[model samples]
Target chain A: MDIVCDKRAGGTLLQVNGRMDAVYAPAFEKECLLVIDGGEIKVVVDLTGLEYISSAGLRSILVSAKKAKVKGCSIQFCGVSGMVEEVFKISGLFTLFSIVPTVEEAFAA
Target chain B: MMKPQGIAFRLASLTLLVSTIILAIIVGYNYSVSRKIIVALAEDRGTLLAKSTAKKISTAFMTVQKVIDSVAFSLEDDRLTEKRVNELGQRVLINNPEIFGSAIAFEPFSFQHDNQYYAPYHYRLDGGPIVFARLGSDDYQYFYMDWYQLPRELERPIWTEPYFDKGGGYELMTTYTVPFYRNRDGQKVLQGVVTADISISWVQKLISSLSSREAEYVFLLSRYGTFIAHPNANLVMNETVFTAAESLEYPQLREVGRRMVAGETGVVELNDLPMTGDSFLYFSPLPDQHWSVGFVCSKKEMLAEVSRLNREVATLGGLGFVALALLITFLAKRITHPLRELTVSANDMASGNLEARLPEATTKDEVGELTHSFQAMRESIKNYIENLTETTAAKERIESELRIAHDIQMGILPKLFPAFPEHREFDIYASIEPAKEVGGDLYDFFFVDENNFCFLVGDVSGKGVPAAFFMAVTKTLLKVVAESRLEPGEILAKVNDDLAEDNKSCMFVTLFLAIIDIRTGVVRYASAGHNPPLLLPKNKDAEWIPPLNELVAGIMEGTQYTTKSMTMHPGDTLFIYTDGVTEAMDKMNNLYSEDQLMVVTNQCLGKSAEQLVDSVDKSLKKFTGGAEQSDDITMLAMQYLGKGSKQEGDDRWI
Candidate 1:
């Protein structure tokens, strides 16, 4: 799994690609924690290229969300579809957070 | 003198010799026969090719002849005069690409209005337009030329010998001439000659493309043996086959020319032809021309196909012979592989390795049968030996195990009587006596800290080696946990969790674990489904303590056990033992229960810890009444007298 981050006008755009299984979940969580700790308040996760995600990956995202909320930072998601969307729906994360069609729309919202 | 290796080498050599000799004879014979057949086939092919070429040349001559006749007939027309003859000649030259040029020449005073001996010629120059010129030059006279004189003499059409018309047609060419005369008072008088020129290059192109080999070629020869349209440009119109015969002093070359120029059509093999070397020649004559077309190919070139085939055949034959020899060697080994294996196996079996096996043989031949027989023999012998070995091994194993288990169990017990003889504050004793070859009953007591004494008695779930192994694990776990200085309950909990993890065998132990404070006489004990101790007080009754309601150790993970404490006065004893003592069955099947153990403990009131434990063991032995002990019997007794001073030396009691 790859986590690529770049700064945008509205926030930091974090593009995640490849399968976010249990193996890569820790690194993803660590990077997320580092980003939130660094005070980058607004973040948009672009998951358009994400192939699959397991429960461990979702747990990492939840941890990131909670930590970001406590730090007064925010995270939005975009390009949610395929197996990643299926995992979100099954894990009830679909209605739990913000999601949009594109990175631009995600930040705009 | 012939060993196995020697015989193989002999066989290979003999086979190679025979194969090489036979291959040489066959290749030699095949080469001779194929050479003869190929040469014969080439002769037929050459004769057919020459005949076809002769037909083509004849057609070209007839075309030129027709054109000359056409020009001669046109001269008889009154509308055509000497003035317009050049124009007609130019038209004839331009109409046929095959014709190099054409011309019409008249005699002197033939036409009264024309100049005497006037002639006009039109011919192509290096692929340009037809060039017109008068033939009246003093240096070259047209009337004296053979093309003019011959037809004038014969008063007929004739083809001239092919020549390099350098100054006339400007090419190597042949000319066809037709003479025309005008009737003078019914007496025909000679007028002039009409000539049509054809480039020999057209015939040369047809002949050169016919042969493929460099040494094989076709050429044209005139009636007088002059070279015409030969593949060798130097020989065309320059040297003849007769001249070559004369130069090389080989008369066969002239004979070949005679054979062609006589209008003969046949294939001739001349072995000593000059310039041509040994060659095959075929000739045929052309119509309306005194010329013969012949095809010649060197004998070496004709037999080149046979030589190539001979080399290929020899190579293939040798390769095939080598392949056959290798296959024979491989097949011999295949037939003998089983026998070789059997030899090795028998040797190994003699050397006392019973695991040696016969190689499998799928063939039903003698070797295969021998292999199967050997397999059966080996199996039976191996089985008989193994059976005897297993019986002896079982007995020895049991005896050794009993000896080892007895030694280990006794070694682990606290054999020393006044276990704390130097301290004088307490006395402890322990022993384990197994009923069978091996047992799992255990008892241990050690000082954990300066003020605390750790004690434990355990019986693993089963008997024999498995139970003994679990007992060892439990003892070690308890000892390690006790060193943490935790409470009895916490220590037992930690030991239980550690042992329960990865306890796939599901073996468990019932233990009474305790920590005693010597200075305070306070005893805190935790029990895991064990028989409680009999507490003996001074001047009071000895009684059995109630059991702790806890599961056995190693049964589960994270099981919590609670501790129970009791304050003891001085001169009190806690006697701990497994059910092996209380449940001991006599010859009459009557068990010595808890009440009996309490009574026996009370009877040893004034004894030391070692004496108390010894007395209990003696009672249990007597109660069994000579029957084999049913289970492992283990016991531990600790007596708390008074707190002895730290400086006191109590070596007298040991």
Candidate 2:
């Protein structure tokens, strides 16, 4: 799995690729933690390449969101597609966090 | 003693045997070559001597034949009478002293030779000469009356028999005669014959010298096979032939002799001998004499060299035997010395001294390398044994220390069950069993006020003394916070701060604490990442009542704890436990899962607090088989019956 990150306009953009199962979840959590700790107030995770998501992967995402909240950083997820979108809707994570279709929409949020 | 030494001995022995066999073969060949050389030399010398004798004899025969031919030619023509013939004879005698006398005879009394030409002389039988006119009662027996008549019959010059000569009158003499024709008709015509009367002493002397050398016999034979001069004088002038040639055993030699008579000169063996040894004869035919000379020498004498060779081979064989013996002894010692040392070293190593090392020599041969390998193996084994001993001792020591820690951990739990035997506000029971040397599960309950009882069950993560230490700290902090007159939520908040203040290694604990008002059966509870406790209603079914709160207690500093309140009805029981109780596993790896735990807890819904704990414990054992508990299984059960006097049969609840 690949997580490409770029910073623009004082916000972090993370592009995640590949399935986020139990094996890739830990890396995703570490990436999100690094961004939050950098004092980035607004961060975006692009899940356009995400094909599938397991419960453990969702839990890592939620944990990262809570960690960001504690640090007073706002996290937004964009480009959610495939099974990752369905998992978010079923887990009620979409109600808890902002979701956008593109990176521009995430930055606006 | 060792395999290499044994092989070396066999190899050395084999080498010795091979060398000995080769030496024997060489000795045999040398013997054969020397014998051939000696035989060749003997044959060459024999042939050379025989040829020298033939050359000398030929020269002597030429001189003698020449002298005889000159005398015969001188007498060939006779122009005078008997008086001149006698004068010629005397002259011949004076000129050639080697000739005894020369005489001439004429048939019909017409001869002139010697002194008794036509005289009527009588031959003397004893020693005297007699006048022919005074012969004893015989009237003038003339020359025709003598043995000379025998020559006239044959008509050839011949050597007459030895007789007492009246003319010479001293020694026995034989007459050599030659007959000739007086006319041109080429017939004898009764011409006078010339006679030479020679002494036999010279022929005897020649035969004696030739026979004196080493089994050699010289003999002369006439052209008609008559023995003239021989080693046996009696056989001289006798008509004799080689009788052995007629024997069947000499058929090959007979054939050879026939060819020899036809003038072949080579080698032939005389096989027909009456007790005569093996002989090799070399024959040379004399050209003028019409006779042959043969040298008969024994074959043993010609090949005496082979005997000398036998003696030389004996000497060489003796030397070879001595050399072989010395080499075998020396080789045995040289080969076995190293082997003996190796044998002793092997014996020492077999006796279980891993430290025992074979001595290595400085050479780079196989034996030296073997010694180095053995020493290296010994050294490695010693090091391995030492390391194994230390590791085993260290493991035992650690296990013993862990056992002590486990005992200390168990001692910390409240071993005195049924702490209040007389109080009847609620019936309560609790148990804690650590999984390892130490565990993080802890249970505590104390009366916060006259009406309120503060009870809690918490499990810290991980195992060992660290978790044990953390559980102790958390339990102590909970007690301190409970005495501060705070509610369940506030008490948890205070404890969390105290535990997380100096926390390293990210250690945390999951806790469920509740404060109950036994008078009203009202309880307030808070959770910190802990599974919810099960509550059994008095008339309804027992179920899990989950509390809503974020993970508190060491997860983050200043993390708040929240509480949920519930009013208890009569005979209702509350069960609180660490996850160890639900997460326990069997040998099949199936868990005492939470779903199973809930079903079991609801089975005895209306049971008292102690009955509820007992039923759950029994169910956990049945579900887990005989598999050991994998964690600290700690539980606290409490019940609140309605605050009133009960019936007589309900006394067991008090």
Best by TM-score: 2
The DockQ-derived docking category for candidate 2 is incorrect
* lDDT on C-alpha atoms for all candidate structures: 0.78, 0.66
- lDDT by residue for model 2 over B245-329, one digit each (tens)? 4533555555655544554455555653433366666655555445555556665665455656666776777687678757775
Report the C-alpha lDDT of model 1 over B262-319, residue by residue, as the tens digit.
8889988888654567888888888578788887878877787788999999889979
Model 2 ranges off by over 4 Å? A1-109, B1-395, B449-451, B536-542, B567-572, B585-592, B602-632, B639-654
Runs in model 1 deviating more than 4 A are A1-109, B1-7, B164-167, B201-203, B209-215, B270-278, B298-305, B330-654
What TM-score number comes out for model 1? 0.42
The superposed Cα distance between candidate 1 and the true structure at residue B581, in angstroms, equals 99
- Clashes in each model (backbone N, CA, C under 3 Å)? 1, 4
Cα lDDT tens digits for candidate 2, A1-109: 8889898895999988976654677898899899899899988989998765544466567678778888999899999875576546533356567888999988876
